[model samples]
Target: MTAKLTDAPVRVMIVDDHEVVRRGIVTVIDASPSLSVVGEASTVDEALRRLPAVRPEVLIVDLQLPDGTGIDVMRRARELEPLQKMLVLTSFDDDSALRESRAVGASGMLLKSSRSRDIVVAIERVAEGLTVWPARAPEEDDELSATDQRIVELIGDGCTNKEIADELGIAEKTVKNRITAILHALGLQRRTQVAAREAARRRAGWK
Candidate 1:
């Protein structure tokens, strides 16, 4: 299902350290009647203090703050108001930041250089409970032996250890051992992370 803004105008809060960026976002939001700026905070401490009074519907936040990271702000906000929607605006697009933001329940993410219209759209979408991220495809290739490649493919396909064993005519314990070895070789802590990395690689057009 798609998310939608409330019947009343969506109340928004800006959380960024940069004065110019904050002003720009405020200008874009204030220009629209469907959205309104309720408060602006340049630090985590400031945001925490203003949140209850502002009770914003959406938070447009940068990853970096003078006092703390956006992830920290999101976490604290969730504690204060679990239903508040969060949209991450950041210059950094590293995998760690992406994973961390999603883990902390950010609804959407946009590059800092995104057009004003796009930023507004992201805020609305996030307020509606939609995830906004760049499209990515699954990765199929890795620097592994043919057997390891087969194992990874099966894992990506969601095959259980016993199912993989059955498919390959091997013992379940052997399949488990093989999976452990593959994880070690790839230096990955989790199968899901490995799968995501592989998918990102494919999305980047790498072999």
Candidate 2:
């Protein structure tokens, strides 16, 4: 947290309820030449219990957990180890959660859907007192707004343009144009491809 100066691999911890997700991220972190996984916890209580002993330099945390929440872990860690840095790794892009994270001393946030390289870079920057997560506050319009994500989910569920408009209480023409833009942005030629891709993301709990 104090601008890591040592060449030793930065000590990192991971906290996520899902075993698959925790292990997947551990693999990515351990693979990084400049990082190392020093500890892991699946619940807020567990994280607090281990913090004093493990003493990680940075913590890669998920927003939701079986017990309390990542905010609990971050807040408690701030008390126990003021120098420990926190990096949020979550599936939800909710603005409220982002605000809460920054208030609790999280240095940066990353989506679980981020590329391996991006995750690695985020941890590295946060460890050095640099920042990322658009490297600042959530923009009014990110690459994908919450409304656009809802539309993608509806498409994945096989909703027709008219049905999507009805569900979202918007005009059908607007739905059509949004679909066109989403497909173009994703570099897909057909709506079916969007359906297939987004469907997979939803299945993996990327809401």
Candidate 3:
């Protein structure tokens, strides 16, 4: 059975580059009597233009947009309507994207692989001002090696490889090599990015 929405019909806006995903989400949301898809946008520009007229209660957004990141759209929407609820629906589970989304005021995060019912539930939860994180297995302490953990900690402290090497009594070249390996393992690009992600992870109680 479909879950009943709140007393009033929940207005929703879908922002995704893929037409198929947009249609699928619209269908799922429209299936319920108390939820409606008021607008759909394929790009940040389109979303900005349409949102004013749609005036949705919740926005389901994808991270990778053709024009720009979905975070930009979320930021604009919040500026346009401070009370709007935003839920990030993206394939990117990277810590950087998650942190940026939260920093820009997304109410919840949902993986695209989530079931349609779960997506609907996420929308409702965010609409009610509750945050939801995609379920994941707990990480073991041993997941990262000692060297990797040290590098991560240093990165979180905003230390460059040269500084970390000087502090850790290691060769700067060795520090660089270790940092490269750590970035590859974490699927990250830069030290600052890692630092920001670490801050978000800490805030979210991931570690």
- Top-scoring candidate (TM-score): 2
Where model 3 places Cα greater than 4 Å from the true spot, the runs are 1-6, 135-207
- lDDT ranking from best to worst? 2, 3, 1
Tell me which of candidates 1 and 3 scores higher on lDDT. 3
Better of 1 and 3 by TM-score: 1
Per-residue alpha-carbon lDDT of candidate 1 for residues 14-100, written as tens digits (9 for 90 to 100): 999999988988999988777889999999899889988898889878899988899888999888887778888898667778779
Better of 1 and 2 by TM-score: 2
lDDT (0-100) at residue 177 of candidate 2? 70
Tens digit per residue, CA lDDT, model 2, 1-207: 366567999899999999999999999998999999999999998888888888899988898998888999999999997877899989966778878998998877888988999788778877766545442222322455577778988998899999999999999988887776565445466999889887777676654
lDDT of 2: 0.81
How would you encode candidate 3's per-residue C-alpha lDDT over 98-202 as one tens digit per residue?
A: 779878888768787878887787787677555565433335223446876777778878888888998889999888766654554454667776688667767
Give the TM-scores of the predictions, in the order they appear.
0.64, 0.64, 0.62
Q: What are the per-model C-alpha RMSD values against the true structure?
A: 11.8, 13.2, 14.8
Candidate 2 wrong stretches, greater than 4 Å: 135-207
Q: Each model's C-alpha lDDT?
A: 0.76, 0.81, 0.79
